[model samples]
Target chain A: MQREHEPNEHAHHGPDKPTYNLVFVALTVLMLLSVGTAYIELPDILHYGILLTLMSVKVGLVVAYYMHLKYDNPLFTWVFILPVLMGLAVVLSLQGLAGY
Target chain B: MNAAHTSVHGAEHGHGHSISNEQHNHMLKFGWWLYIASEVMIFSSLIAVFMLAKRLYPAEEEHLVLPLVAFNTFLLLTSSWMVVRGLVSIQRGDQVGLQRALMITVILGSIFLGIQIYEYNEFTHHGVTLTSSMYGSAFYIMTGFHGFHVFIGVLWALWAFFKALNGHYTAENNIGIELFGLYWHFVDVVWVVLFTLIYVM
Candidate 1:
């Protein structure tokens, strides 16, 4: 078998074309779902929940697959996720304090 | 020593390679992620402020042209996928494939930026300037920052493309391309949040 010439990170190839295609499909679906929620007349909580959940998932998919975080060392994932989570926590706390 | 460094070490444990190429690349990758983390902090702060502004002013979403922005979002998402494909191509040692993929990514990112410029023009024409209203200001700040990031990513993509054209990245030393992929995907992820908060909500 022909070996890879100069594979980066010690020749550990990340996700392939098929995985990328799958991720693309998933992102589009979640996006459409979010857009659908926007048009439909739903309860505030329900609409917010759907949109937030789908947005998070879509972001997760991009970070995990497209960013190749899932394939890399776990540190990069935490490094990327921690700040956003910390900010979310702060925002939620502030919202709670404000009686939101 | 560390799991993250294991790949670097495992490849060249005692060959002084640790002091050389592979380890250096891994460190560069990690440092780039740290930079991205800092970027996340900056964006999160802006997002918190936007949330507060949004609560006060409440965005007038009726004026938002969802179709165009939605297509733009799709364009970014697809462009991210293309970046991944480009990385995969180099991993398979196909330099031409990588160049083609980067060219695609550059095209998609450029189009996204163009649409953003057009959208800004439309919003301004419709009386939504940065200083017009609190929500308008916040909207511009958030989306403007993202647009700036996209512009940088586009320039970065062009640079990476030329590098690919010059045969800089190979299957073994393609960390530069990987780093580009990470930055591009981070831009995409940020858009996912902004699109929901600014437009859909």
Candidate 2:
């Protein structure tokens, strides 16, 4: 003797999953904040400092989440970041040799 | 066929299997990084030359336009976000979303290019040409090179969008999406550093 019907228990994947929309929203906020701040004048070369800091934060977000490097092996992240550090070092050395 | 020849062919296919698509994709990504390293060297030299020349001729800063470059930077930053959204859409298996994001990205990229052309126009309107002064030469060379790269990236995004419309990518097969995303982000990153170096500082 069969009844009318029964709901499929596993129709959907799961009830507990994180939404990435919040991450996008946060990134958008940071991007806008940085752009707005760029309009303000800073003392001396500190403008580069502020811009670099904000750019790093923005790049960090993109690399970690958007690039999926967060879940990737630490070694892979090292490969991507090592070039950045090296590039900066090269620039610093070149600037030093060229004087101010 | 001879047994020796058959074994040779079998070993060749076996070696091919060992490399795998993932390995090939990683190889291409690493190649991109190496290309960026070369670019870093090139820009470092350009900055060095610019600083040296600026020290010799300190009066050229009067003609530089800051606001237009800032607007161009905003255009690129927004375009970067759109590129990421496209990749994310592909990751989520949303074909329509991917197409929409890519379209927005191309539009933003075009706006950036348009701004660059306007900047060039402004330069010429004010009697600034590549042969005008050392500053003018460096300015056009550095930024013109970057603008050309942006043009290429826009075309790449358009092609990717077309392919996406034709069902080229799926959640499980989205390495192409990631590769283009990486290239797009690299272009954005280079512009970030450039805007700071060339315009702000």
Candidate 3:
């Protein structure tokens, strides 16, 4: 009964198990790429720019898929993302205030 | 002909029921996500403080060991994958698989903490203690708190593993495991930022 129940549930709501494996592979590859990027001798600003971009992508993938935010209700996304947006504002404001 | 149409309609009904169940699961996940968002606020404050201290004492970067930190990053990332695999296993009704994956995750988390202890010891040898300067304080507070979270996550995963041993979770009902994955993944995400800021930058 449980096995029968899962296919229907997954078909209705979520990705298959194979997709999770694919996502895992993608995450690992991205992690390696980020670490590799760190060693490259680009100018400081551009180097950080690439690293931050990669980091954001990794975060997005984990939150959206691994955390099921992508398939979940939009309200959950808003609930989680709003505070993060607020946090970003605080960081930026503090950076400005600190004369950075 | 009528029987064929009735069977088709029943199939649609089954799909509808499945969707409702899926939505119920999402509602539970929403509550967990809200808790995670609160966690985000806590970490954000610590991160802001760390940034301020870094600005004040820019030369503290010399005390950080980037290669070891990167290796630790790999450990956490691997553990995150294991937890996700654990969730996938339980979702498929594979109790043994779930337990195995979660056990690996716990082990990886422990090793990550061990490496952290080693790093802290190294830092102490290099004259970087919590009271050494504002930079030292911020570094310890941020990374130490993250390490604490990893500690809690390892314990949480162990509990989940035991629960799996008792067959407490099923494909239709595994909110406990799912919530654990969410928390673990959040911890990993926090480390991603902390690693970049504290070590790389």
Candidate 4:
């Protein structure tokens, strides 16, 4: 298999054209959904759970599409994702300590 | 255009070949990752402190001032949209459009900072100070730090806007723009977390 070029990284071609506009629209819709969800009077656990889930989805979409993590290689994944995982670990620990 | 150097550190080398180039980018990438890690630690600490303060001052929870922050959130969200639109403009090689979008982003950012300052004055008038109470301390520190980031982002966007006017970036060589996009998106992400934690919660 031919190696991916690095100099003009953005000018890359794939089996199908990247649908950035579509991805952006979807992101906007997700944001709106989160906002609407925030206004709902759900139980506290379910409320926070839904918000966190939506946020996780939003972050995934932004990373994969806006940041092009989806198109990149595994090396790129490790480079960026390790810190995020560590951050999540820290957040979880903090939440645990806070008794939340 | 410069010749594509065959060195391991040039720009095209990837894994399994020249360990030098691979290692070089990896070092920068690792450093950036560490920077983000350190940032996570710092913010987490601040958030921990905020939580402690909130627990100690549950009475202030009823007095939680959120409308201004909600408006501030709108400003930030609008600015994020503008910055993303500017990136799309750059990708399309629309210099005029890029300049316009970046200008809107900068203006919105400035407006955000302005409202934040105004809110600070309002807080002071209402006897809220850095040492006033736990609520005041946490509220100011967390929101103040975020406002500072917005200020820096505004400056960064302004610089990029001027560069675009000077024909500095092309669709083919717009890594600077993308880097700015990363910073902008990061700021937006931070605000998203803050809005949920500090305001909505």
TM-score of each: 0.89, 0.75, 0.86, 0.75
The TM-score obtained by model 3 is: 0.86
Candidate 1: segments with Cα more than 4 A from true spot: A1-10, A94-100, B1-20
Q: Indicate which candidate wins on TM-score.
A: 1
True contacts kept of 4: 0.11
Worst window of 10 by summed lDDT in candidate 1 chain B? B1-10
Could you give candidate 3's per-residue lDDT for residues B1-201 as a string of tens digits?
112223223565576322344455666787888888898888888888889988898887787778888888888888877877777677777889899998999999999999999999999898888999888998998899999999999999999889899999887778888889889999999998898788776
TM-score for chain B of all predictions: 0.89, 0.86, 0.87, 0.81
| Top of the candidates by DockQ | 1
Candidate 2 residue pairs that clash: none
Report backbone clashes per prediction: 4, 0, 0, 0
What lDDT score is found at residue A9 in candidate 1? 33
Docking class of 1: medium
**Which regions of candidate 3 deviate over 4 angstroms?**
A1-12, B1-24
How much does candidate 2 score in TM-score? 0.75
Instruction: Give per-residue CA lDDT, model 1, range B92-173, as digits (tens).
Output: 7889989998999889999999999999899888888899887788789989999999999999999999989999998877
Query: Regarding TM-score, does 1 or 2 come out ahead?
Result: 1
The pairs that clash in candidate 1 are A6-B171, A6-B172, A7-B171, A7-B172
DockQ measured for candidate 3: 0.44
